[model samples]
Target: MITTTMSASERFELSSYRIPGSDSCFYIPEFITEGEEAYLIRKVAPGFRPALGPSIYERLQIRDSPVQRWKQLANRRLQLWGGELTSNNVLVAQPMPSFVETYPDIINRLQQTGVFHGSPHGKPNHIIMSLVPSTDPSQTRADDSPGTKFVPCLLCVVDIFLTVEVCVCVRVRSMSQAKTVPPRSSSTPSMSNRQLQPHEDGPAYHPAVATISLNSHCVFHYYRYTLPESHGGRSIDPTPVLSLLLEPRSVVISTDSLYSNRLHSYVPPFQARLGMPDQRARRIHEIKEDRFTAGGAADFVSPIANWERVTDAATREVLANGGALTRGTRYSLTCRDVGKVAQLKSFVKR
Candidate 1:
């Protein structure tokens, strides 16, 4: 998005990356170096997160091993730092690992962006590491489970022989935005890799959110919650509000209303056949993530709010050519600040 010369941390012209209709959002590309991304990936991975200090682990009685902190969800794998929130939306404070709490790779870099200037903690106290499962057809099962099982969402990929019917872009708008769900686990597609159900972040945290994408690229969307309606007996279609390409090592900073007021979801990374074509072509199998059945396609158009600000040439070309791009393994560090923290030690017994 915005590129400006400034300090030793980052070079960002934040205003240049704002989303048009949004109150405040900055889509900054190359926010971290490739080496930094790799290091973050290793640190954030659940089984590989840097181990807790021996003294602290011993005091807590947790094994000093690489504690399996990762929790696999219905659609994505997650590793939460700063402990999990309770049913009442209380975040039991647990000191974050060195990589996040004290290390300068992410939090330090984010501070330079100045997006968290007025946050409760003056910085993000909670971080959720998310990774969508790969969508390769080889993982498809006869039962049509996650990787390759088709669930109708905003887009569908149906192909017949050498031809395909896929809708790359669609017109989606936000009708309303107001809801307060518990900060509980969410169920989504990680493998046919199904798309996540459209939803908003919990409102318990500060209204600002900074998402850092790493390793691979992804298409993240912002939309209001509205169920499809059958109009004039026509097929039901989803309505999306805004779309953006999240390039690797890039960070999307959304503040005020966008992060706190609307729903967001990421498309599944894998492709699946929506139907079995003529029996003669049963042997043909080449996965195209965006190919869908046009017989039931939605109105398509590339309306990414920050398309012009996109700095990646390849992503620009893909958007330029019908606005369809393949999904890849994406690891996102979703950082936020939760003002209310209950000490976990209070609940632990001696």
Candidate 2:
């Protein structure tokens, strides 16, 4: 057997910061300064989107959402950046825009942290961001669902093996679209559940998954089990292995065994509760009143479910002082690289 020999740090890049209660998870708070965050939003907002056409822009304004047009997939809606990537997963071989390379210095620092050190391109060439609102149905938008199954599509190009459409970037929205807390009995879609799926970044791209959460906080749960019998894998209990508290402005990266060895998913209806153990609570409601209103919605609440803790001492230190994990809305940005462009082209043409 060819034993994979490498330092523990080499496997997960966990040395960049204190381990977050798990050997695989790393959390960095304030990864981007407020100013830089504002700048990024300004640059990517609808006003500055790459030109699809005046008609598309007009339609976008009328629709009141960035995803006015595009094919919606089972997981989440998609808007291809840097021109449509080839089906084989390689970009058109064009340089990413200057703005992409110009993301805040912290992003550059992320590169130095060695998170993407082993990727084919040594850096992410594509970006996928999602804006999901709270409140079901009313939460309906154009985003596609990734569905519940993992279908492996493989093709070989030259000497390179490729897998198509593995999720590279999966960002969850982070703010309360409601802006104010409604009656607890009131219903609203609050969490972007797909953002929390336990699926792997897959074999097509770098194993590392860089996720950033904005606006609110939510619990991300992970499970471990043998690949299903039909897939001919072993048997193991799919028990809760870990759960992460994704806070606004926080950055989390996971890879190596965490990427390939487990399944993860987020419990929906995210909220901010206080006065309870995060590991033993569930957030079954959304914050509908002003997030700061007294006695209304605290920044943190007891999530109603039993979550396996994955936070570190440092992360807990920072979270303890916040205004409860306020139940504002949220958005997640997952950056990844998927391989399989050459084969994708053939399918596209046919």
| C-alpha RMSD for every candidate | 16.4, 14.7
> Can you write out model 1's per-residue Cα lDDT over 1-350, one digit (the tens) per residue?
44432333665656766777676778877777676676666555323221221111111111221343446676666767767788887788876667654444577677777788887788888888776644444322222332212222235343323444442211221123312223323353224246665566786788888998876777666766445445633221243456667778888888877776677766642221211111111223332423232211122342566666667777666555543555545678899888778887877853
Q: What tens digits encode model 2's per-residue C-alpha lDDT throughout 1-350?
A: 11122221233344644444566767665555556555654443343222221111211211222222333543334344334454454554333335445555333545655778877767565555544343233322222222212222132111112322322111222223312222333233223333333454456567777776654455665667755778787554323456557655666777778777866655443333322244444333454434222222222343322122223354354445422332333446666655433433554687
Candidate 1 segments exceeding 4 Å error: 1-13, 45-68, 101-104, 138-192, 226-237, 269-302
Query: How well does candidate 2 match the true structure, expressed as C-alpha RMSD?
Result: 14.7
Judging by TM-score against the true structure, name the best candidate.
1
The lDDT leader among the candidates is: 1
Candidate 2 local distance difference test against the native: 0.45
